[model samples]
Target: MKMKNIKLIGIGLVGAILMIGCTDLDEELNDSVNEAAGFSASDLLAGAYSSMRELQHEQDILASYVHSSDELIAPTRGADWDDAGAWRDHHLHSWTNTHPHIDKTWRDLNSRAFNAQLVLCNGDASATEIAEATFLRTLSDFFTLDLFGVVPRRACNEDLLQPPTQQLGRAEAIDVFISEMEAVLNDMPTANGPITATQNAGRMLLAKLYLNKAVYKATGQDGVAQPGPYTFDPVDMTMAINHLNEITGYSLEDDYFSSFTPTNTETSTEIIFVSENELGGATGNIRNRWHMTMHYNQQPSGWNGFVATADLYNLFEDGDVRRSTDIPGLTDAFGYNAGFLVGQQQGPSDKTLTSLIDLEDRPGNPLVFTEEVDIFSSNERNGIRVIKYLPNLELSADADGISFSNDDAPGNDYVFFRYADARLMKAEAILRGGTDTNGESALAIINELRTSRNASMLPAVTESDILDERSRELYWEGWRRNDQIRFNTFLGTWQAKADASPERALLMPIPAEALATNPNLTQNSGY
Candidate 1:
């Protein structure tokens, strides 16, 4: 067979297998091509991009990280989200090697890395195509290192059936990842109002890796797999700041909610890299952020599984616009609060919502979401629900013009890197004993963000204050686990959690399935 024919066959095989696995079989089946015999290099590159989307949505990876951090929690509401206690295990930091989500995320990310490698191996690809594939592979590798403390390694020519893929530890992996990103930085295109691999995206990724390099290299508290007592190398910190400063032509959105609306891809100026999701298109799972948290009685009902803790809610000052509660009676196009939902709930019709009697531990009153959660006997509506990403509300004219009440899939592009994050990280690096070009202090940087959000300027800043700012700014967008770990706060007691087993709980254990499939893998300490 010709090389193109072989590559096409490989693409078709992978697509068919993935189609069978994705829950929305109808959509995936429709997307799966009958054969890849006539596919071009761009078609293969598009396949790689689609695989990257899978990494974003698969196995609840985003939710797992949010729940594990201080900002959010997945409480078992009677019987709604027990999930074999998997949800609670994250908040409690007690997940085992066999944790289903952990294993699924591992497989999903590695599969993307491998698929990207396959695209590169097909010698017919152009230089641009090669750069794009390398970008995708590096993205997967970055996540693998961030979450698992190890990066799975395989060459483009490696056989799929190989039993053991080599692994690189955190320090080695960071060095290699940085070098790879640097090589492709200039080749990546700048965004032209559409999502694509870009120079800004590359710089943002490199900045993040450099900022966390100290945590990646830290070693202390024997048998504890947590981040520092970090040694923030001045060179790495300078590089992080310099890379962030180089990115231009983006700024913070005036309205905090604008960045997360259904039309965020076009509205948000802060986004540098995003997972492009379209409701009826070939990609986009960003709607899960909304579907997973809102109450069932609300318009576009949600799973009602995840809730923000009082600690996170309390971080917002009384006048802070980020707190959805402060914006009373204001609703988005979706008729839901723009941020956190608390107290009495309202639907699109402006009618008060009441929980069904059959709901576990029903309160028999208006559905009131409290900041406090009992963890044991909390009512079905005890915790404050999040609506950070507005629910999909577009109604088809042919269908009585009623909005989608429960869209399991939404189209808002999920932002992975944004300018605000880069700004915040710059602030953090300065605070952690690094200097800036203009002699800006960490407090000044933080105040700039606060002032933009209409929040009160703080008199002074501390490490704890910076962490709180991070939660307030970046909550539900991911980065909580990493922030917590980097600050040595992951194992601390918070809300309903106790600081038990702080050391070993920092890094997740290598999934049992991964170890079984690859003999070269070893479990993290204190599994």
Candidate 2:
């Protein structure tokens, strides 16, 4: 395959069977995404990559992670977002096994695993294809274990007719994934850049697994587990540092949001893994970030759902580029700055920037986002909105539609892993007892990124400082729940979910549908 520099290349695929849950009613688990007899491995591989857009949009899987964490919320604005009381359940950690998002997320994640393995199953997969497939499968399996406990496992050439009996538990699954990812890391392409599975991306993925190995070890495969002060062994920490060390030739972006803009694939130095979005179409869902938060009256009007909690917004100090910035053409043209959006929002250069109306609570007012928000009820403009994945204002707006809809833009590649995160992970690994691979103290290493973002130097560093720093730099990128769990602060009360959070809440329960479909899957503790 020709090296794809930055385009999120789309492989025309005969998409596969969704693999409803971890189990299959018939023989083929994650049944043939392509029902036809003959299919190319490349097509299956593209399906695997394309499906990863689910991770980009803050919905379903990412929604569960964000709504559960302290960083973001999906508060019911009167009657607007109160669907199934889903967001409320996630915020309160009062979700049941049958929660809709939980079931859907589980299915979506396993589907990725099944699709990747599908590529491997196809006899024609090249070495590069096999390497990428292996990485995707492990990535899917990794999240499955992290969010749930056990992941479905099947041997190569295993009977498609029999009910399979191998489901690896947390520790066992983690070990298997680590071994498998390491097994293929070196074979991954080095020249594909961050848009595909490259050696550097493999390294970053392995580092993540290793950093959380202690937690995986604590959360056994049979599934009952809680949040922890889990012993981050020096060996695991060292392995994380070592893998991160292998990821070379990348650095933090001078402008923090540069890592997230439309040209990120070509411009950002920090990206380690990203999805290729359309240059002209909205097939890519990166546009969801902006539309999900900004109010209807704001330029490129949004759904006015998903808002950031103040706790996360308060973490940044003055002059931190990560906090907010104005994208030259986009921000000036559309009236909203690109980071933590608070106070009054603005409209595009139309006859007049739109105004608030029909919102009974505050009609005829500007589209102002209030710092305060309510979960059960709030005016339309409540809580600060975020715009990490900036809109592509260059796309021609619909003459009749609200500035731009899905068709207007989606060129921004969805960022997965990045260099800044790797640096932070190494610093955290050292703080947890590993030797400093960067030859700098954890404080100095963190300060390097801090100074790059124009944030003031920290006088010192602590575990709390690390957690806050991660929040400031990586907010709304969909890793908060993982960070909070690792730091043992997941259960801490924040703006939304008050009262003591149950430790079992650290790991969501296996979807009831999954438990019913696959007996091998066991529920986590306290569910």
What is candidate 1's lDDT per residue for 1-527, written digit by digit as tens?
A: 00111233345344323311323334433343334424666777776776666655625557457878888877777777888987778888888999988877777777677667656777788777777778888887777777878777765544434543567787678888889888878877765453676788888888998999888777443323444667788889888888888888888777877777667878888888776666655545666687677777665656777788888898898767788633333363334467777777654442322221222223456777889886545667889888787756655445543446335556677778888898899898887766688677889889999998889999999988898899999987888988988887887888878665457676777787667656677778877
Model 1 regions more than 4 Å off: 1-39, 219-226, 325-336, 348-363, 398-406
Q: For model 2, which pairs clash?
A: 8-276, 16-33, 17-33, 169-221, 170-221
> What TM-score does model 2 achieve against the real structure?
0.91
Clashing pairs in 1: 277-284
- The Cα error of candidate 1 at residue 210, in Å, is 0.2
Please, what are the lDDT tens digits per residue for candidate 2 over residues 1-527? 32322222222121112233333334342234325224577766776787776666555556767788898888888779999898788888988988888877777777667667878888889988999999988887788888877787666576543323688888788888899998888889898787799999999999999999988888643566656888999998999999999899998888788887777888899999876776665345677888888887666667888899999999988778888888776666667677888876665545333432222123666667877998889888788999888776643444554444343456788888899999999999999999764686899989998999899898999999999999998898878888988999888899976787877887888887766756656678888
Number of clashing residue pairs in every model? Answer: 1, 5
- The TM-score leader among the candidates is 2
